[model samples]
Target chain A: MSHEELDQLRAKLDDKNMELLKLLNERGNLVKKIGEVKSKAGTKRFDPVRERKMLDLIAEENEGPFETTTLQHLFKQVFKASLELMGEDEQKTLLV
Target chain B: MSHEELDQLRAKLDDKNMELLKLLNERGNLVKKIGEVKSKAGTKRFDPVRERKMLDLIAEENEGPFETTTLQHLFKQVFKASLELMGEDEQKTLLV
Candidate 1:
């Protein structure tokens, strides 16, 4: 590939990165809302059943060169990050 | 919050999940192209300097309920998944 092709690909990747960042923040907003609801209801923050279902759903939908295990692992990280975000908000609310 | 509010929040989360999935696949496509370029150039697959720059950029941009460390860890997983996809493709190309 030429220099131009490489630069174009990198530019595309950067665009995708920005999109991911925006989507993650959007997800974080939803997580905070859900956390508040769960806190009010006296429910647990982490739902193992829902997590499993999400992994299963992703696996089913994946038309991947990526393995199911890799998708599961990556999604697990994403899930954990969202949970941590929600957990931190709950802690702050408790302290206030 | 009421049942209706919870349902709305959950619906929004589902949409975000789908968006994330699409973005991830889009990133994967770029990774594959970059991988091919790197293979031809005999360059390293893992670029620690570039990775650190990305993490720093994310931390700077983060208006987070999540800490920088958490972002770093989560992004490392995302990076790993992309690298794995690229590596697998490289292996297939080698075999052919």
Candidate 2:
């Protein structure tokens, strides 16, 4: 097995990681925007129905070496963090 | 405020999640391939130096509503999972 093959594969993995990074940050920005809208509308940030729907969609679309449940758990962690961020926004609004 | 705005943003968020799903599975596949090569070459699967470099790159690139530290933590969780997956491949080879 050529070291070159391993090196090339690592490069590709790095590229994928960067793509993931961009998407995650983009998603974060969207969540913040949504937070602003929700704050204005006086609507609560956590919508269980929508969260469940998103998780279901992920489970349906997953074709993976990682199990659907594992991915869901990881995604939920990010989603929960996003919720906290929204809460932060709410707190800031209250302060201001 | 039209509910339509919230719904549209939700749709975009879902799209971003799907993209993340695809990239993660793609990364998993690459890691598995790298595991095979490493197994054949008698090299260890986890390379801390490479891992550190990748994390550093991510920290550098993070421009976020999500802090760089938060992104790094989230990424490390996924990376650890990938490492476990590589271990699974190694085990299957030994079993075979």
Candidate 3:
């Protein structure tokens, strides 16, 4: 590719990466909200049933190059991170 | 502060942040290993009991500006991330 074309391609790639990061952060925020709901309900922070439903929804909705398994893995990490933020108090009390 | 001093301080801060990231990643890997052991033994993936023990150890070992609760929060996030990576397979099967 020409120099200008190469630069344009690099810029596009950077934009895509930035978009991914933005989406990830947004998802993280949502997870935190979910954690708040669960905690306030005096429910267990980790809900395997809800998580299963989430993965199934994603799998059903996905039109993807990525497999359901991969999506599940990525989102699981995201969900866990959210839960940690929500469970800060419990971590100290329960763990210590 | 002099420009030189400011630059040096910024560099130190960045270095410290990098060090923190490195330690976090190292801990993440260890958690994954722990998860493997837990799964093989049919132990529960999320261990609140062990986490509390960890916080206590850190608190006892700490001579620090950061409070025990703060450490607990940060490390809890790290541990959750590690669990997510380790539990990828279960996420799909269990969640779906």
Q: Each model's TM-score? A: 0.92, 0.93, 0.45
Model with the higher lDDT, candidate 1 or 2: 2
Ranking of models by DockQ = 2, 1, 3
Interface RMSD, candidates in the order listed: 1.4, 1.0, 17.7
Question: Could you tell me the lDDT of residue B71 within candidate 2?
Answer: 83
For all predictions, the C-alpha RMSD in Å is 1.6, 1.5, 17.9
Which candidate should be chosen as best, given lDDT against the real structure? Answer: 2
True contacts kept of each: 0.51, 0.72, 0.00
Model number with the top TM-score: 2
lDDT of 1: 0.80
lDDT of each: 0.80, 0.88, 0.52
- lDDT tens readout by residue for model 3, A1-96: 234443454354334333333343444444454455555566576768856766676666544333456555655655565566657655665787
Clashing pairs in 2: none
**Candidate 1 per-residue C-alpha lDDT over A44-88 given as tens digits, one digit per residue, 9 for 90 to 100:** 989998778778888877766667787778778888888888878
Query: Individual DockQ of the candidates?
Result: 0.65, 0.78, 0.02
Clashing pairs in 1: none
- CAPRI class of candidate 2: medium
Interface RMSD of 2: 1.0
> By the lDDT metric, which is better: model 1 or model 3?
1
Please write out the lDDT profile of model 2 over residues B1-96, one tens digit for every residue.
458898899889988999989988999899899988888898998888988898899999888878787888888888888888888777887899
Global CA lDDT computed for model 2: 0.88
